[model samples]
Target: MGLQKYWRIVFVAVLLALAMIYREEAERIVNIVVSSPPWLFFACLFLVVAEFLLQALRMKLVFSKNWAEILRAYAVGLMVALSFPSRTLGEGARIAVMAKELKVKKEEMAAYVSVERVADVVVLATAASLVLLEVHPFLLAAAVLGICTFLAVIESDTVYRKVSRGPVPELLRKYIEESRKIVKDRALFAAILGISVVLWGIDFLRMWVVVHTMGGTIDYTAVASLVSLAYIVSALSFLPGGLGVYEGGLAGGLVLKGVPHDVAVAATLYERLFSYWLWILVGAAAGAFKRENGSSSTA
Candidate 1:
């Protein structure tokens, strides 16, 4: 746990360094965002908050017996989004913390978090497939296949257990058990999936608003596909909320659709300023509240 704290400190320090070096670029981006109509800007903010609310509701559904545990789970989810890949361990830590607070076994929490993450992948793949014809068809097909495999493994108790028992070592028995639990919790998993999709949709809308503010000629499909692809990349970036990587990916996608490179860069930066940083502040506040209140998990 101490090591994890040290890693987080290092990650924050690195983010500060990067932000300082790119201060001019970041400021330039903010200027464009400020120039946009206030209503449009506020709309984007509303969507972000809505995303969080939906997630909170989903968490409640997932841990139906434990209202307090739901908050802790949702808080961890927010923390995961705020820090992203940089706090890779934070996801697992959140699960561990929930288990500790709820007096549940660690394996149970692990099962839940694992289901949450896998559901994210399944949800994204499904959504991407509906609009698959718009982007790289091959990649979309691959995503579909991956989603199918993931569902097959984690959503089936008999098959998962059979696979776990065959060839795999006895060391992985706990993993099999947890995966079975994930399968058993279908209703909660679906709820989380719905919330995850809605969250991503809100984020796409926010990006679209930023693009419009920059006077881009892009349409909804263009905006959604590009933003979705960027998210897929950034989610795996392992950087602090994918800071530099996300901005670059968004800019690149916009430029590919014929938007001016500089404008794309500026818009991406502005969206992050309002969205990412704002969420970080909210996550920080929630974390502080959790600590101060000595909250116990009810899972």
Candidate 2:
């Protein structure tokens, strides 16, 4: 195996070692999972499936494509994102699928996908800000959104001219210009953000239902930020599916927010079980069906 693959394996091994360290808690976590309500589990699973559809629609709104094709592309990306440690594979898959399926220009696809991620962060942080109620965090989120907008709004030709004397690459120039064009589309920009809010809102509510089913209750508004922050923490370490790390961060965060530690852990694990591991399983099934059906003519 290549050194990179070896490193990822080592990270997985580290994750395993950490799980062993918490072996007893892990056992209890397992029991809790085994006993979770079957109906509730299915409901949460349905929510996850719906969330995927909504997410694909969000992407399509910003970059026009047949919805089925875009969804297949996202499923392919999700499969790799779940199976690997690196975060970029899914993005790389997204670009490749769009190029292959939608004939989207690579640079243009990159520009819009990058913007979509920034917009996702903005929208989630806004949801987080909703319950946080702290002016400083809201201001910080606003600053982040402002910077992303600035990048998207900057005149690429002017930027290139200013740095033309430098060693900037042609590809970077194209990407920047594409981003500028995408963000300048006021209608598309508004549509993307609007879709984003709804997307993240549903995502947070999915978690709320899971927690509620587990006999834990939380402030309705806090669900958005809690869910957002938990996910943000999971992605931060670049571990595929966040594995053991998400449990700690999520449970700890919930404990700080007044949930009993045991309840917090149970809720986190249940939600992750559905949203992470089961998500990968569902993606694989969907991908198989897509392949068997061939690309939809509509796609």
Candidate 3:
């Protein structure tokens, strides 16, 4: 454990060193940030708050829990996700914490988490495919076909029964039962997907605002494509908050879209400042608050 801790520190140090290596670009990023209008910063902050609230709402719909507990779990989860190497662990932490908080079985919570994860990925991929329609028709078709197939399978009772009768573990069977309950409710399923769409739309808007704040311009479609691609790359990279990978993908993609390198860097940094770093702070505060209330617990 100690060796792993040291490796994490060394990894972060290397990332910092790389940032300093580009002296001129780093200076430009600082200047761009300093010169940006204050209102835009507040705007981005508001969007972040909105995003979290929406996320909590989605959780409420899934878990049927009180608002306070749901938000606290979500904040703690976001914190863990940003601080850790893989998002899967953070989500697992969230499922455990929330299950304990609600006094429910972990398998039950895990079912909802699984569905939410799939819905989010499907929504993101669909958005990316639509944006890339003209540029990559094959990708659009594949994304569409994949999403449809997944939904059909999840909604099919025959498949669910067949899996249930198979040599599935008892815990996974419980999870599957819960998942079937969720997907069986067409209204609930649609509502969750709707929330996901709105959530991702806010993300795209936030990115657009960040770029404009840096005095850069890009169309909304381009912004959607860029943000989707960056997130996909980051999620696959499994880096904490996508970290260097996300930053690189966003800035490089923006440059490819004709934005200046400095501005692209500035936009990426500023967007991450609120979307990623700020959430970490919020999670810390939530964890501290829960602890202070004598409800401290670990995932």
Best candidate (score: lDDT) = 3
Residue-wise lDDT of candidate 2 within 108-134, one digit each (tens)? Answer: 878878777777877766666644445
The whole-model lDDT of each prediction reads 0.68, 0.70, 0.80
Which tens-of-lDDT digit does each residue in 183-264 have in candidate 3? Answer: 7888988898889889889989999888977878888878888888778778665556677778898899899888888999
Worst lDDT 10-window in candidate 3: 1-10
- What C-alpha RMSD separates each model from the true structure? 4.6, 4.5, 3.0
Ten contiguous residues minimizing lDDT sum, candidate 2: 1-10
Task: Give residue 117's error in model 2 in angstroms.
Answer: 1.0
- Candidate 3: stretches off by over 4 Å: 1-12, 130-142, 295-299
Q: Report the C-alpha lDDT of model 1 over 107-216, residue by residue, as the tens digit.
A: 76666667667666665565555346565688788877876776677667687668776887553567667656656676656667777777777877888877877888
What is the descending TM-score order?
A: 3, 2, 1
Q: TM-score for every candidate vs. truth?
A: 0.76, 0.79, 0.90
lDDT accuracy of residue 60 in candidate 1: 60
lDDT, candidate 1, at 135: 58
